[model samples]
Target: MSAEQDSVFVRNFALVIATLVGVTVLLIVIANSVFGDMDPERQALAEERAEQNLSPDFAVRLSGEPAPAIASADSGADEGGVTEVRSGEQVTQAVCIACHQGNFLNAPGIGDKAAWNERIGKGWETLTQNVADGYGNMPAQGGAASEEEIRAAIEWMVESETGLEVPES
Candidate 1:
């Protein structure tokens, strides 16, 4: 083929490859977004993402070692948030922090804005409402009966995850 024809062919091939790669990445992100929230405890902590990014099946096998602070799951040994509790720190400590602690719930890994953007896209109030009413794997009031407790829990989680100050209105 002529030089110009070769260049055109190469450009088209590059475009096709680039498009395919873009679609693949988008699919990966969407899949991760949809399924990353499955319970990823110390038993399976290396998870798909961690396996893809961190050590290979390392978190799952570290059973004898202490379960490090998880990304966002609470193995609440205290039966956390089962009743009316208004302490922000407590509610958060008891409840939301588990799944909200890190990237466990397709989360932004506590303080990662990029991870929270879409949730924030729904508006903070809406997000708060979801926490109050329960969304997906999360329980209502994050399993707390008290509104204040739930708000507090959400505020703590939001602040920790995004560093954004929640207003009391």
Candidate 2:
């Protein structure tokens, strides 16, 4: 082929390659924005680029499935992934109180001694299971609290109702 023709062919190939690269980048950027940070590839890249020495104690961590955490009565429950140690009262206030406060969805009101008495007699296992599996109009774990958190909230409500303390096992 002639040198001039060869040069023209090279330039055209280069232009095509550059165009393809630019279009690929634009498509990636659009997908990242539309899919948000949940895009696996984008999220992995962001996490890899994030400061390696950053402390989790200062930041909220995200995960697909939360790891199980050991719960203590004095310290409270810690559902893994975020490692937030929430107290029973905190759980109740954040979740249970919404429904239990006024019998919304026929939930037993927090301080309703009579209403609580019958349910409380069913024992901790039954009550906790109910919270975990969902009971009546209440969703499973009500607000999706960990098993320990549900137990704590149940104990807190029982005590508030009848001045009886439920053991945390």
Candidate 3:
């Protein structure tokens, strides 16, 4: 291209860049003028939302550190310092239902007599122990529920649902 044409092209390009920069600046100014004077209520709401969004969902604890106290809905304990034991149905619905309802990870489906029949043969003690320790794809439920709760869940999931009594060992 000729020098004149190159100069014209450069001038046009410069103009285009300058226009974009001016437009950007104008937009920023307009936005600040429109939103800078936020009402106290709106500003407070925005701040609250920001705090909620930025809050961490979980905490990390190193090994051997004392576990953080968990907030429970029912914090009342009995005279013996034992918290109220949840019923079979409650435990089964709350914990066992997650896996047992759908037979997830090859877990026996709730109310599946055929499946419970096989496990029922393993007897109550064995089945409860297996559940407490975790068997197959199931994780150790000992941490989630106490031994009494575990037994209740098994009774509910196996005996009540399947109509097959777990043989007491």
List the candidates' TM-scores in order.
0.39, 0.49, 0.53
Comparing candidate 1 with candidate 2, which one achieves the higher lDDT?
2
lDDT, candidate 3, equals 0.84
Note the residue pairs that clash in candidate 3.
none
lDDT of 1 by residue, 39-146 (tens): 657438656556677664344755564444444343453342223345677776776667767656564455656665546556557677877787886666744646
lDDT of 3 by residue, 115-134 (tens): 88877888878888988998
Better of 2 and 3 by lDDT: 3
Residue ranges of candidate 3 with Cα displaced over 4 Å: 1-82
**RMSD in Å for all candidates:** 23.4, 13.7, 7.9
lDDT of each: 0.65, 0.77, 0.84
Give the higher-lDDT candidate: 1 or 3.
Answer: 3
Off by over 4 Å in 2: 1-82, 165-169
For residue 88, model 3's alpha carbon misses the true position, in angstroms, by 0.8
What does candidate 1 score in Cα RMSD to the true structure?
Answer: 23.4
**Which candidate gets the maximum lDDT versus the true structure?**
3
